[model samples]
Target: MKGFIIYFLLSSITGNPLMAFLGVIIIYSLIDRFYLGFLPDFTRIFRRNRQMKNSLKELQVNPQNASATFSIGILYFEKKKYEEALKYLEHPKLKDNETANFYYYMGMTLMKLKRSDEGKDYIMKALEVNPRIGYGLPYIALIDHEMEKYAPDRHIINDLEEKIEKFANTENLYKLGRLYKKLGNKEKAKNLFSKAMVEYSYCPKGIRRIHRKWAILSRVYKIV
Candidate 1:
């Protein structure tokens, strides 16, 4: 009702209903982009670009700045520039970092580079550092699939199942279920799909934002 009232007032002021509707849409999109986080954040990309530029400047002054190098690598990784990401992520200064996230991103970038074996190794290191890392299991499963291995790491799969049960991570369940399907385990896949649906149904409102995309995808999975 409030939206309609605003639309009506805007239409009266503009003397054109179509223009008013477009204006309302623009305002709503801005609100979602800034406050609701439902829209893509263009500002974040710009901010990252600015940070990357600053990191480059920092590197010119002190080539031994590991943090700046890692930051640049992360920025490039987010931009999907895997080769550039590797250059900094593999720097000697970072050899002893032992950060789980560092290894995880290195593994993911290597996987993108089609170096599945190296990717798998780094992913394993990440799991050793933090078994419960979000998305770690899924990437392991993905690498297993890429290598044409029927047996995904059972430890990772088991951990993901535990996470789903404890945290109601519908996304992980859905993805793991897809992995099972790809591995030709129809029965396990179907069971996980069912659980994913049920879990999404019972997902709490507070965490719905995290699960909503997977929940919607699971609905489509149910039909197919």
Candidate 2:
């Protein structure tokens, strides 16, 4: 009702119903972008493409532009063009420098390519270089990998729990609970699920949209 009223007011002011509807859409999208975050970032897609093209042009001129190469490769990775991403990401020895981000992106791209072994190696290297990288997402990715193999070790689970305790967030806590549930540790799972909800409760309103799904899901899982 509120949105409809706003739309009606906009239409009346503009004297163009189509323009008013577009304005409403833009307003809603901006709200989601800044406060809700439930919607995907359409602007990022456009920015990635433009940056990729600019980087490609720079590489065409210099051919040894390490910065441009990495930029293009990461952009390709973001675009889900893994094969192409790998080509550029690995083309240079990164001037023989092994940065954490390069390791992580390579691992992720390899994982997407279905080369799990190589991907896991790269991801582990990334974690070894910086345990706190990607806000503990590297640990989450490994947990997911272990799940795929149906052989998640208790050590891995405990390590994730420790890291998650230090960097508690709804996404990581919920995933940790999921890991416990997968291993038949119902009590542990419930504890983690409850923690997830606690973390969500303290989350800032502007960023709550990022965690809302996991918060609601954790509530459902907590009771079960």
Candidate 3:
């Protein structure tokens, strides 16, 4: 529809009826097949590169805008271009919460790239810059859990629990409950899950996952 409108406008400006109709059909067909349809891999790559180039141009115009850099970094990260994200996010102009978030996401990207030690270091730096951020803690715990699955360290779990108790936000509650479940503390997990269900009833992801976990646990305990 949008493509048709654009083609119509262009053809009207050029004052050519046959050209107008053909232009609309051609433009619409290309868009319907490539942009709206299952485009080829090369087309997807080309689009992504074009988007990155545009984002880079925007960043150049506003070099000190941490949000712009972060936005571009996020785009790169989504494309699995970790090196590019790292380069943009680690620019010295980034500071404050944006910088901290950049480090946290960089850690996640590094972890995805399978550089766990480097990821941990960046995540630790994120936490150090702002302990109250509440984002890096879960990543740290996740790394720890990955390293020693059976005997996961309790310190991260304990600290997270305390933070959840104090904050009681949806994210904190969900994380704490999952961490409890991972640590083989079923009773604690159940309680935390119940709390999460109440606190995050309106949140689709939290509600669904928490309720599913609660139902499973209830069945296991013969409570329902």
Scored by TM-score, the top model is: 2
What TM-score, over all chains together, does every model reach?
0.72, 0.77, 0.47
- Residue 127 lDDT, candidate 3, scale 0-100: 71
Evaluated at residue 222, the lDDT of candidate 3 is: 27
Please identify which of the two predictions, 1 or 3, would achieve the higher lDDT against the true structure. 1
lDDT of each: 0.76, 0.83, 0.63
- In candidate 3, which residue ranges exceed 4 Å CA deviation? 1-53, 59-70, 78-98, 134-151, 179-187, 201-224
Q: Write the per-residue lDDT of candidate 3 for residues 1-224, one digit (tens) a residue.
A: 77678777977887987788888777766764543332335666788788777877887897777777777877788788888777876777664554567767777777667777777777777777766554435453554445354675667656645644655655555555566666576787677667755655564662454344433443333222
**What local lDDT does model 1 show for residue 153?**
66
The model with the greater lDDT, 1 or 2, is 2
Alpha-carbon lDDT of model 2: 0.83
- Candidate 1: tens digits of C-alpha lDDT, residues 123-218: 778878986655545353453544365654667656545654654467777777777677777787778778877887887778766666676666
Better of 1 and 2 by TM-score: 2
